[model samples]
Every structure is written in C-alpha cells, then in structure tokens.
Target: MTNPIPTEKTPPDEAPRFAELAGQVVVVTGGTRGIGLGIVRLLARSGARLMITGRKAHRLERVADELAKLGAEFETRVSDVADRDASRRLVDETLAAFGTIDALVANAQSYINVKPLLEITPEDFDLVLDTGPRGTLWLMQAVVPAMQARGRGRIVTFGSSMGQTGAPGYGPYSAAKEAVRSLTRTAAREWGRFGITVNCICPASASHRLPTNLDGDDPRARAFAAMYKDHPLGRDGDPLADIAPVVAFLLSDASQYLTGQTLMVDGGGILRA
Candidate 1:
C-alpha cells in the first residue's frame, strides 16, 4: 500500500494581495521543516524580513540561506523554545537584527508517542508541556511586552485537532495545545487594548512526520483517512495553500478586527459531527 500524498490547487492570482507585510519583521519558531517551514516560505515570499529559531544550527542556517535567494532578509538563531532564557534570547536577537518585531508565529512543539495516560511517565509529561505550553507562554511574555509598547502586533499560536476533540493516547499533547488555545484567548483579551491581536490555528494538513506519530495501523488513522476521502474538497489539505493564507491574513492588517479566535484548517475533518 502506498501512502496518500496531500495536494492543493493554486489560487487564481498565484499571488497574495496583502503585501502590507513587506518591511515587517516576523519571527517563526520551529521553522526548520514541515508546516513551520511552509509558513516561513509563504511569509518570506510575501516580502517579510524573517527571523527563524530552532534547536539545530545547521538546519536553521540552511533554511535562512534558501530564503535569502528569494529576496527575504533572513536571520537564524539556535535556541530551544522550552528554555525561557533561550526564548528571551530569540526575541532579543530578532530585535537586534531587525529593529522591531511586527508579527510572531509560535510554531515550536514536540510530539510524544501515543500511549495510555498511566504509561506516560512524569518526565514525558514534563517534556511535552514544557516544549508546547510553557514555551509558548514564555515566548509570548518575551515578545508581547515589546509589541504592547509599540501598540500594535499580531500573534498566531498553533493548536491541534486532537487538542479540540481529545483523541485517545494523546492526552499530554492535547492538554498542552488546549493550554495554548487558552493562552491565545487570554492574550487577545488583555492585549487588544493595546492593539495586539492573538489567535490560534488548528491546522489539519498532512505532513511527513505526522503519520509516524500516529500508529500506522491504528483504527484512528484509518478513520482519519476515510474522513479525508469524503472531505468536501475531495482531498487532503495542503499547509501552504490552505493554512498559510489564513496565517498571513491574521498577521496582516487585513485581520485587524479579528482576535481571540481559533480557525480550523482541517478540510472539514473535525466537522463531521
């Protein structure tokens, strides 16, 4: 059996209209590969000066170099988002490199193997919580101060379908992402007075690593595939095509009136209720 490949059709214009992001400084965490990388690519193509952070120095540098060819002013930092000090350093470095941060995409996260709640050790729980929820909180704390000072900013936090529906064997991950959703709402409420917008996206696009995370033979995976088969769009969603534009909209002034909202990009997978 062959693995299903995800695909998307190009928009009619083959170009985005919200070019206001040009000259803006944006930071994206965990941007070395997968969905994060897709966001970085789209944002760069839209002419934002991008600063990306990840734990791997080589991969960060490689991605920075690739984006440079597309006329994006790029910078990279090797930092683990789970570390508060490192997260602060990432923001400081971005400000030092780009002068100001106009938008932030908190996309860094670690996935653990699906196991029974009792099977998960305290250490495993700590690792996921630290990387997903705690990291997001610290990063927001570090950046929002500056954004608030400026009286304008955009923040996009990542959530998951599992987080919304509480899938089995993914307790820790779901819990962490739920916390992210909560944080997003809270930030939007508190920061809106300062002209800052905070929102979360529950992205359901296919990725190379997600299949391995889900047990290949599990009934859950089969159910997911069948849902996609009968999706309203008749295909798996592409992160670049389906997810990136929404993110760009949230980041741009186009979505200035929107905040404290969770947008689902799941090809109607979670809407089968």
Candidate 2:
C-alpha cells in the first residue's frame, strides 16, 4: 500500500488550530519538500508566522504560493545551512522579520555516501557531517543570543532511527545524526536556565528523500522496506499527520518543560530504545 502523501495543504477550518502557536514565529530549515514541507504546512495552518529556508529558489517560490492561499504570514529564503555565513544570516533575517524566533525546526539534511564503510571517502563523510551537525550548530549559535535575550525559545532537531541503531551502510549519516543529538542535549542543558528547550526527533516517514537505496532493489533496501511495512503501526508515518503534529507540540508553550530528550516519532520502529 502506498502512503497517502497529501498534495494540498489542509484547509485551516478542517484541522485543529493551536492557540499557543498563534502569532508565534518559527524558523524551519529545508522547508521545500518532504518532512520539512509538511512541518511548514502545519505551522501555517496553526497561525504561526513562518520563516522557511530552502536551497532552491523555485521550490521556495512554490511554497510561498501555497502559504499565500492559506493566508499565512510567512517569508521564504534560499539558503544552504552547510554554509556558516548563510546559516548565520538565515537566523538573523528570521529574527529581523518576525522580531523573535520562538522556535526552530532544524530539519534540513543531505543524503550521500550510501556506499559501505570500507568504500566511503573522507569527502563523503564530511559532506554529511557538514550538512547535518555543523549546519544545525551554526543555526543554533546564531539564534541563541536573541532567544537568550528573550529568555525563552524552543528548538527541534532531526535525528534518525538508522543513526541510533547503526544501519549497516549508513555510517556517515548515523555519525552526523548522533552528533546532532549531542548538540541538542548539550544546548538543552546549558540554555534551560534561560527558558530554552532543545529536543530531537527520529522520524520514519514517507519522504522523497528517504536515503538513496530504499527505492532500489538491493538486498539492504529490501530489508529496510520490509522493516517499514512491518513496524508496530504497520506503515510508515504520514509526515503531516504523524510527524508534524509532534513538532507542533514541541513548539507550543506546553512543551516548555520538555528538553534534552529524543522522541522516536517512527510509529514503533524498535531500532532505538
């Protein structure tokens, strides 16, 4: 069975709007497609002012049009989080636009080096590390000053079950994600006194960027596909319905007390405890 990925954003009337999110400002990295796009749609519907970032201009333009239809208050930027200057500028621009960045969805990541650990090159590993942990750290550092000044903020970072469980061919990606999880924990502890909450989510959702092999017929791909089909929920998560709602909760005021935790939003994939 195919996962029913919605092409249209849910109309505001059809979904429950979150009062805590109303007028809040959120910065979502890689908000052009897949899980990032899903997060943006949910936040828009819930009345959050959005600053969405993507590497491609046209992708951001399309998302801008979609949010326009929803009457969403938003701004879009073409940015590569891997670039330190761009990441800093992204946070600065978001704060300038929204006056305060109440939350950050550090959801952008690169997919590369699908080869075995023996065949992986230094470049391949560095690319993933730069795109994942390094990028996440840059944005976090840039945003923290403003958030600290305000004495409150929420940060949601992405991790992966494959990262946690040590997937056979995913050494670099796993390393990067674990590094990001470390960043989340350290930041949460250091900044909690200032009212900042940092958390990580490991999601197993139907995404266009579901690594490189799962769509192929390789043995490892077959194993992963079978695992996805046989998870406790019996299907991969719907990004908007299953994953985004959890992100919304993390961004809400209700989650202020929650920090330094990794939530497996993977519908019972036991790859990680």
Candidate 3:
C-alpha cells in the first residue's frame, strides 16, 4: 500500500497566502515523505516547479502523481544522496527539466544504528556522515554554479537539536547533524556574495510514525509519551503547521537578509541564546 498524499487541512477560503513562486524551480531531496513532503506540498501550492527525489522510484512516482493533481509542474528522480555521482546528476537532471534552479532543500538524511558513543564503529560513523553532511556538500557544490549565474538562490539544509545537545544512543547521527550545521554556516558566508543564502532548520515535526504509532499502550507508545511530556509544547509539531511555513519563508524573498541561522521548529523544545 502507498502512503496517502497529504491534503491542506485549512479550508480554501482560510488558506494562508504566500509570495509568488510561479516561475521558480526547486529541487527537494528526500521529498517523498515526512517534513520534506510537507515542504514540497507548500511549494506546490505556491506554483513553483519542482524536482523531487527519493531512493525509491515507486515512492517518487507516487508523490509526483499527487503533486500533479495539485497542478504542479514537477519531475521525480530515484537517487541516493549517499552516491556522490548520483547527487551531482540529480542537479543536472533538474536543470534539464526546468531550465534553471532557484532553490534547493537538502532534506535527505540517514540515521544509522543507535548505539552508545563508545560502541559506535568507524563504519557506523561513515554511514551517518556520508548520508548527511557529505551528501549535502556534494549537492551544494553541484547547485552553486547555477545560482551564481543568476546571482541569487535559496538553500535550506536540515539540522537537529540532537546536534546541539547530544542524545543518548544517537552519537553518530548527532555528530553528522553538527557537521551539517557547520557546513550550512560556512556555505552561507562563502556564497553570500554570490546572492545565495544558506540556512538550517532543526525540526521536531512528527516522523512517519505519528499519531497512529502513538496510539496503543506499547513500550514505544509509553516512550513517545514521555518524550512529549518533556516538550515545552504539550505535543510534537504537525509538519504543515509547525515546520513547512518556516521553510517556505526561507525560500521566499522576504528572508533574503537572513542566512547561516538555524531555526528550531521544535515547539520551543531547545532554547538557544
């Protein structure tokens, strides 16, 4: 069975309007599910042409079809960000389909086996780093030239609160996320002159296992409840409500002056000074 396509929960008359993005083209990695999908849906509503990618062809096609229903102009690629060659090619494929690239959302990531810091192997570290920061670097390098030609671009990368305050049993994943934050800051400074803004978002929106998975009295449910109880907000965020609108802002012209910052959309979970 396929995951159902998401619908805007707001009534047509009450939907929030955003800046025009009719001719803009965006490339979203890992765009088939989770917060990435939420970002894509918002962009679709804004009339942006999109190039969305995922490791699974079936999922990519399913997502593309759903976007088509919204009258979105888009293309889909089945590629892994961990493959440097494929990541570069993804840029080429998007430009081929869309003529130019205006923005990129580097949302692809991998969480390797959760284990204690001492027990984390070199292989595990490599897997997490390779998929997270390494892949983001490759895609950024590939897309920068196009943005330079136009003298403008928007780039959004994913960071995590785990990177700031380390999480137990998530050592390698946390480290990789920190590396991505470093990359985001460095790129923002380097590319600012070229009219590109790079920022990171640390989102605590629901993962695939959301309300349904939170149901029942299993150990997982109890653990999830404990986690939510500690949040500043009583519950976790909904992707469309708590996350994607912020992403949409970063991609819009209004956020032109902001770069190298990490916006924590975690319902105030982690406070940064």
lDDT of each: 0.81, 0.84, 0.81
Measured over all alpha carbons after superposition, the RMSD of each candidate to the real structure, in angstroms, is: 2.8, 3.5, 4.7
Candidate 2 lDDT tens digits, 1-273: 233223444443454557779899999999998889988988999899999999899999999999999999999999998999998888888877878889899999987846789989989998999999999999999888989999999999999887877777788988999999999999999999999999999985555544355566764565466556546665556667667888999998888889999999887876433
Candidate 1, position 214, lDDT: 35
Candidate 1's C-alpha runs over 4 A off are: 1-8, 11-17, 210-216, 219-223, 226-230
Residue 10, candidate 2: C-alpha displacement in angstroms: 12
Q: With candidate 2 superimposed using the best TM-score fit, by how many Å does residue 41's alpha carbon deviate from the native?
A: 0.1
Whole-model alpha-carbon lDDT for candidate 2: 0.84
Q: Which pairs clash in model 2?
A: none
TM-score of each: 0.90, 0.90, 0.88
Higher TM-score: candidate 1 or 3? 1
- Candidate number of the best lDDT: 2
Question: Candidate 3, which segments miss by more than 4 Å at Cα?
Answer: 1-17, 205-227
How many pairs of residues collide in each model? 0, 0, 0
* Higher-lDDT candidate of 2 and 3: 2
